[model samples]
Target: MNIAELKEDLISYSKTIGIDKIGFTTASTFDGLRNRLVKQQELNYQSGFEEPDIEKRVNPSLLLDRPQSIISIALAYPTKMSKRVTSKKGERRGIFCRASWGEDYHYVLKDRLNKLEAYLQEKVPDVQLKSMVDTGELSDRAVAERAGIGWSGKNCSIITPEFGSYVYLGETITNIPFETDEPMEDRCGSCNKCIDACPTGALVQGGQLDAKRCIAFLTQTKGFLAEEFRVELGNRIYGCDTCQTVCPENKGKDFHFHKEMEPEPEVVKPLLKPILHLSNREFKDKFGSLSGSWRGKKPIQRNAIIALAHFKDETAIEDLTILLTSDPRPVIRGTAAWSLGKIGGDGAKTALQHAIDMEQDEEVRVEITKGLQLIEE
Candidate 1:
């Protein structure tokens, strides 16, 4: 079988099945990425959500027997919402990052990978293949870089020239020998837009990231946000896109190529007050389909309270009071107490004062004390 011909046919089939970009590379060890991961670990900068084994993450040969080549695919998601939610006066909203705006990209990418896998299987009767999406052992960014799909940008994202960084990446490691594409040159040059725009200065320098300080990483944690980074979160509930949004390569690079990748205006940017009151089932029914909802509703709710505080939303004072006084989760109650103090309404101050006396949890009590302090100042 001619490997070159098979590669050509696969590329053609990829377009018919909605894969925006595809590339191939030898299944070699990722030396640079391995070193970077070690350094990131030493600095305690990793998000802790990554595959823990550095060997599995950087060495494709370890994942599949006789791994000869890896095929990387990129599906571009829309950066701009085609539809807009009509927000009323005094109505505040919290935003999920663009990556989570659409259907859970994991499913979308996996479906495409399945199709590619099937195609390869039919062509090579005994094809040994392993496909992976975001949660896979291998770093999708590193695979995409080696596969020539895009260059690793300063913000630590794969920046494709055609789609910018708003692309979902997936990969298939195969035993079949295939021709590889040359990797793209780094176009970022000396431009520091993404690094300069990071809200928490998470982009420490160029390609390095301090995930501990990254708002994108912080918003996903299912616990009380440290007071230091709470203000940096702004209206973000799920992930941060500041670095990508500010990139010169991403300028006006919105693409609605795939229908499944389209953002529903209300879902991506939901009303802050409604989010604070969502029952677990209601939250699941509304947000279960989106990737941002994976961490469940607690984190989103906590962030919503902070976003309300960011706006000093007098209207949400009632809801914040309810959360502060009776919410089961200490994080929610504590955050509500903090938000009430930040908003500073007459009733909000009253609620905080009452919470100080009734709250049993020491952490919640501390938040209540802080809220009272804000009211005093």
Candidate 2:
């Protein structure tokens, strides 16, 4: 089999199948990534969402037998909404990060990977392959970097020159030995924009991230948001984009290359008050297609309460009071109590006074006290 010719043919086929960028690399163990992951674990910097087995994560051979090559692909997603939602006064909205604006990228990227896998199988009938997207054991950024898809940026995203960091990454490990591409040179010299812009200082330094403090990671947690980070969340209901939005490389990098990645402005930036009352069915009906909904509606609803407080919207006082007084979920009730304090008014104060006595949960009671304290302050 002519391997070089096959590589070129595969690259051409990838473009025809909606893959924005594709690159190939040897399936060698990611030595540098293993060390970094160990350090991150020691520092308690990991988000706990990743595969616990570091060996499986960095060693492609563990995932696929006799893995000879790895192929990385990227699909560009839109940064700006093509259609705009008109803003009306007192109708505060919470924003989802650009990554979660459209259909879940896992499905989108997997479809492309499946096509690539089929193409390889057709050419080499005995080809062995294993594929993964974001939830995969191998780091998408690490594979993409080695495969020459893009350079790893300070924000921990693969920043393609053509697509900036606004890209979804996926990879396939194969027995076929394809020619490799050179890694891109780091273009983030002396630029601290992504690090400096991180709301919770999650970017401890240039390329290192303390995931526990990252708003994007924090937004996914089902528990109560850390008090110190609540104010930092702003109106971000799902993930934080401060780092990517501030990057100079992404200034003019909006791309609408795939229709599946287009945002529905109303759904991505929905009214904050309405989110507070969404039934499970309603939440799924509205946001199930987006990647952000994978964690279910609890975190999103809590963030919506925080967003309402960020706006200090007195209009949402009735909704906040309902949640504070009667919500079955302690996290939601406590978060509502805190938000009511942040959005203090006569009505909020009255609700807090009533809930402090009636609330049974120790944590919820504490939040109610905090709410009352804020009103006094």
- The most accurate candidate by lDDT is 2
lDDT tens digits by residue: candidate 1, 140-226: 999999889999999999999899998999999999889999999999999998888888889999999999899988998988888
Task: Please give, for residues 96-196, the per-residue lDDT of candidate 2 as tens digits.
Answer: 99999889999999999999999999999999999999899999999999999999999988899998999999999999999999999999999999998
Please report, in order, the local distance difference test score of every candidate based on alpha carbons.
0.92, 0.94
- Local distance difference test, candidate 2: 0.94
Q: What lDDT is reached at residue 12 by model 2?
A: 94
Q: Over the full model, what C-alpha lDDT does candidate 1 score relative to the true structure? A: 0.92
Q: Weakest 10 consecutive residues, lDDT, candidate 1?
A: 81-90
The C-alpha stretches of model 1 lying farther than 4 A from their native spots are 86-88
Error of 2 at 241 (Å): 0.8
Q: Give per-model CA RMSD.
A: 0.9, 0.7
Pairs that collide in candidate 2 are none
